[model samples]
Target: MTSPAELLALYDSQQRLVVPEHPPAGVTFEVTDGVMRVTGRGEGFVETTQHLGLSGGELDALIAKHRDHFAARGEAVEWKTRAHDLPADIPQRLERTGFEAQEKEAVLVGHTSDLLVARPLPAGVVIRETNDHNDIVGLSTMLSEVWNDDLSWLIEQLEAQLAAAPELTVLFVAEAEGTIVSGARIEFTPGSDFAGLWGGSTAPAWQGKGIYGALAAARAQRAQQRGVRFLQVDASPESSPILQRRGFVEITSTTPYIWSPSAPLGTQS
Candidate 1:
């Protein structure tokens, strides 16, 4: 297991810092006053500064700067603040500035060995790992159906990431008659104890058939194969209990603080 500070650093350096999609031309990134601001004409987001030591007033000034940018563009922004962020009172400031809280995800961390790897798949579903485009596209489409979003860009991003880091990522699909019905991806964070289970889902009709469990098992098995010791996920409500049943413990709760011009800027000083 990684130390809490090392785990935090891993998340900061390897995950949160990645801008998966290139923001538009006007969109920009900066770190000022202990805040990381991603601003653009129509959309923006802010996060606690990266590993920098700052006083409370500096952090507030950072938030204030982002607020000003969004005010000018009339855009909505999301602030991703972790529980470990010093001065937990930061969220209080955001609330004063019109950012409303949303669902908090359970951050589940478990040893890869803790995962039970024998869940049976649905009657007609079979699991497979693929480097083929057709298989990846099918998996992407199934995820889009489950998440109810246009996930073409997600597909592209995953493919690109896999191509760049082939040995560190695994994309698995549960297919029936050549059509994907469930899927997930496991991304290995090299030189670290952690591997991530991302984008897990099953088709509506395929739910409760143990497909999710099987897919999760497959990901865990692969993580173990890669010598990874820990598996972590920011699990949604539906998956959290199931993961708990599988012996994964919920460690922390994380919620994204979304700020939007569409929302009321209540009580801002």
Candidate 2:
């Protein structure tokens, strides 16, 4: 049996590499010296996933350089600093400066082929395949409405990714009355044994409907179809229990630490 702590470590290790190789297609990164700064133009919901690898000083400078960009556009950022390889006072620094620390979540994962995805969903909820721009746009729009984040960037990235690697990725949506209620993206990480279930979200009016879970199951089913063995996600508290109920286990907690010179020093939201 795999312990949660061990699983957490595995998740942490896998996530640490997310910045290096598999950054979201919409985000852009610029490296200077030993620092890498990542910025998402329209898809800047979680800054932690966007930017990786910067010393304290480097982060401060990057924040200063991009302060106007963020402010001009009125984007809220959850700057995440990992607990490992970071300053002890990083959260304090973030708070002292300006950024707010939000709830921390554990990365959770399971065997794709082992997940029992046939959970009961609320009535009128249906999962369906999405391949065109309109369907993709609708999914993105619903997610944005749920989280209040822009989806144009996320949609653009997904479009490019789906175009390039159709075999490795599948995007799905849950709908009611022809409007999207929940959505998820399942990516079979190329050249690896793992497939990821990402961006699981449901509309506010549709909570407790199991739409998210059903969509997750659909993604896992897709993964099984592709012969992948592992399914993974960085889950918030709300979704963690859902995954756990379906056989996913908690891995290590992943805290994203962030700093910008013009704003707070360290913050995670």
Candidate 3:
């Protein structure tokens, strides 16, 4: 069992090291006014902040700066705020500055050992890990249905990452009768004991049949096999109770604030 303090420390350290507000390939990343801003491809955001103790005037200026940065690119920006972030009033400041708060999520952490318990898979369901192009496409398609959005961006991003650093990301899918029904991915951070679980989704018809639990168990086993000690997820309300039942404890909360241009640039409104 991991203590809350230990979990917080782990989260902070990982954020500073592996998951810092750095840009991925083809994205422009910059740091100004203690904020890390990233702009790219219909997506822009303040990825991280440091030591920001600003007066209201400064906050307004900073907000305008971010708005201009994304407006020029015609992208919607998301600022991810954690409960433990410094100055304590950042979320309120963001709301006042025109950022709309999205859903709040529980930051759940658990020891890999606790998550490795065996679970029986539903009949005709098969779980496998693969990097084959077809498998990636299938996984992405299943996720797109689950998320009700075009996840082709995710497919491209995953392929790029896998090509560059195959070991850094792993994709798992649950198939029934040769058709993909559920999927998820795990990202291993270099030089850290943490592996993040993301994109865990099941087809609507496939939910509540133990496919998700089976996927969780498989990912946990893989994490432990990779010598990772901790597994972390920013869990949605629907998934929080499921994970809690599997030994994940809530460590913190996170909310994403989004800002989009009134009309996307280059598009007729």
Residues 1-269, candidate 1, lDDT per residue (tens digit)?
Answer: 55555656666665554443433344467765556677653457777644446446665665667777887887778888767666777778778777888788887877787774766766778998876788888877887887788776555656666776678778888898878898888877556667889888888988888888888888888887788878888899999998888777765567888777777765644
Q: lDDT for every model? A: 0.74, 0.65, 0.78
91-145: candidate 2 lDDT, tens digit per residue: 5645544665667776677888556456698788888878788888888888788
Clashes of each: 2, 7, 0
**Residue runs of model 2 more than 4 Å from their true location after superposition:** 19-27, 30-36, 43-78, 120-124, 148-153, 255-269
List all candidate RMSDs to the true structure: 4.4, 4.9, 4.0
Top TM-score model: 3
TM-score of 3: 0.87
Q: Which residue pairs in model 3 clash with each other?
A: none
- Cα error, candidate 3, residue 222 (Å): 1.8
